[model samples]
Target: MASRVVRGGHALTEYLNAAKAAEPLYGDIQKHVLEAALRPSGRRQDVLHPSEMVKPDWCHLAAFHRLRLEVEPAEKRRTTFTRENIFQEGHETHTKWQRWLTEMGRLAGDWHCAVCDGYFWHDTTPAHCHECGAPSRCLTYAEVPLNAHPLRIGGTADGYSPQDAALIEIKTLGLGSLRYERPEYLERYTVPTDVGPVPDLTRLWRDFRRPLPSAVRQTQLYMYLASHFEDLPVDRTIFLYDFKSTQETKSFVVTYDESFSGPLIEAAAAIVDCVATDIAPRCNINSGSGCPSCLEFEEQK
Candidate 1:
């Protein structure tokens, strides 16, 4: 039997609920943010691939990406008048963020492509396409239909390089000591029942023990399929940094195999089909969390 500590309505449960509720709203925010980021280019005719088109469930992921880029120099200091800066404030808290981004941009200047299209390097070498003149295009998103499932699988990858023929997934971590826990760690951690007060380390450890939480892992899997099926050599890397101590953690790398892509695509298609058919998808949050738009609809019912 599952332990009481592993029961539903635990902190993990609440966290998943909040994540679910934020999904649609985050998608909206992402659409706005990405549009803002791309607006200065004035490339209206630059068509979005099916996966690149923002979906109703993409808000959270988009917000995270926006926050990450907003802290990068090329994006932060590009120009206050740019669409990326439309909602940014020049306040004290943001000032440091802006400065950090600027400094990082300077340090990373040589790594960027001269073509100015939006491709960035994930390796020590610069990303360039000899045949295309454009720095390798990363498949930011892709929409593909799977036969096993009736719905279209919408997916977004971190980055891709046609030059090197590589697919890269980027993960960022903010200031903290790093430790990789095994699956057994889930059995060791306990979820507290009382809500009065929680220890910081306990909370962190509990969070660490939580699995990839099905939905998030599935999304990543979908992204993998979207990029890998196109014949890109897939890779994953983590960028771990400690904000408080300004220390860097380990940068781990992994390569993906093509055999995994087809199954993931099928899974993504199944998920999309479930969503389209009004069937409650087997996600962390079946009822949809506190997304304001979703909430309004719920209230009406």
Candidate 2:
């Protein structure tokens, strides 16, 4: 049988409707859970990551815990950070987009031409060094293997400090989805519609609810990637929760505390140690589960 997947603001509602028509028992269960979830505090506490609890180390080994995080489906979404938040229909191109980003950095950026200390402001758009005639470079993007969760881990190492990155991804979960479901929470939001230089477009945030499991998992995976690069700056790991919904987009910045990297580093190291020593601690109660990731040490003993 072919697997089926459906999504939208009314996806769950439609899903439950199908269930009610076909399987009343399971359908009622879904209704019960969803109704509770829609309550003021109906969230499932277990799903939320605890600040004190570091996730199981993701060694990407044959180990299951590590593998699950690596293999899990990620939200399919896309986001763009443009300087112009301005646009013209059928007028924008990636080159133009990059140029706009470069232009916006004129005053804020402390970078100078490598060969000659010329100002980028006066140079031609997509400026070349006036003194030495060198070209300006835009940020590079590299694709990651997780298609269920397409992500690009790219960063730049300028002279000032270590490398920093803009965590870009195809985001399917809108920012409005993560917010509380208040009466006024369902307001229309402004979104950019153009990726090229053609023109900027706008859309409304309709029917978007809490994030999908895949999207949040992808966010965590992005954080894990940050641990891979010990030199990755804290500011680089931060992401703008910009997920597009039918015709419109919802956006907000989701920045993490720089200190959070410490936990990720330690978790990464622990996973590495497990792999180096060939040990798989029980991930949960070992009731013939063949795992090692949970349970107190005494419980295991």
Candidate 3:
């Protein structure tokens, strides 16, 4: 099937709609659980990792957990971290930042497909019209009648290799006390067979999770999907550059697999169904706190 992936504000709207629809069922529960999770202790004053400050979606968190599981064994056994481990750590931040930034950027027309011409919300103005080769100017939200659900798709490649028409994703991190002055760190880190090492996973994970940004993941996803669908060979690399200490940290290149999409598609489908039916699905995993909506419904009993 053609990818229905949307970008920018339209994606945010769909997510918000899903959240709103699920509110009665899962919103309050999620909020309450997050509140507790954020505050592991009774005191709410305790600070959290900067990345934790931004509430990441379940998919990003789950992906990170999966990545962690892949690496834990290596770390436990004192073996060199594999390419997969580094990739996961680099990806953890990418997923979190992409969602947060995309949502925020929607406020300023930052979200839209780079490939197509139509606005995600309204199909009237064509960014590029086929008939006259005339570019349809983007009308401000105020000027144009917009659709409740805008179509968001497409993204510009950051590190594109024009010669090969390949997109390269470089994931990086800033230098820290430990990583700094350690030449061996870069050698031990893994890279895709295409890209060279010099990119360390351990340090990348630390930085990636520290300050979350958005565009990174969106770009990666778009590139991955576009390459996959177009049957193009795209080079995706994550360069872990340590800005704090001014060092070129580590880099890795990775390819996507069917396993990655299985859960995401399932989650997206579930959310879409919930929005369509206005029915929140049950949480398969018991959170132990009990379902608030159900508890309230029972209180009336």
The TM-score measured for candidate 1 stands at 0.33
For all candidates in order, the CA lDDT equals 0.34, 0.35, 0.35
Query: How close is every model to the real structure, measured as TM-score?
Result: 0.33, 0.33, 0.32
Model 2 TM-score, all chains together: 0.33
Which residue runs does candidate 2 get wrong by more than 4 Å?
Answer: 1-140, 143-170, 174-232, 236-245, 258-264, 284-287, 291-301
lDDT of 1 at 18: 35
10 residues in a row with least lDDT, candidate 2: 81-90
- Over 26-138, each residue of candidate 3 has an lDDT whose tens digit, in order, gives 55443333323222233211111112212233332222222222221111111112322444556565444343323343211222433353344321233443433344342
* Candidate 2 steric clashes: 27
User: Taking the tens digit of each residue's C-alpha lDDT, what string does model 1 give over 1-301?
Assistant: 7322212333334334434545788644544444344334432221112332223343322222222223211221122122233235212223343234333431121133335434433323334533335643421222122122233333444334333343333332221113232333433443455774322444343354222223234334544544544433435422222222222223233444445446444544554444445453332223345444233333543
Q: Which stretches of candidate 3 lie above 4 Å from their native place? A: 1-159, 175-224, 228-243, 284-301
Lowest-lDDT window of 10 residues in candidate 1? 139-148
lDDT of 2: 0.35
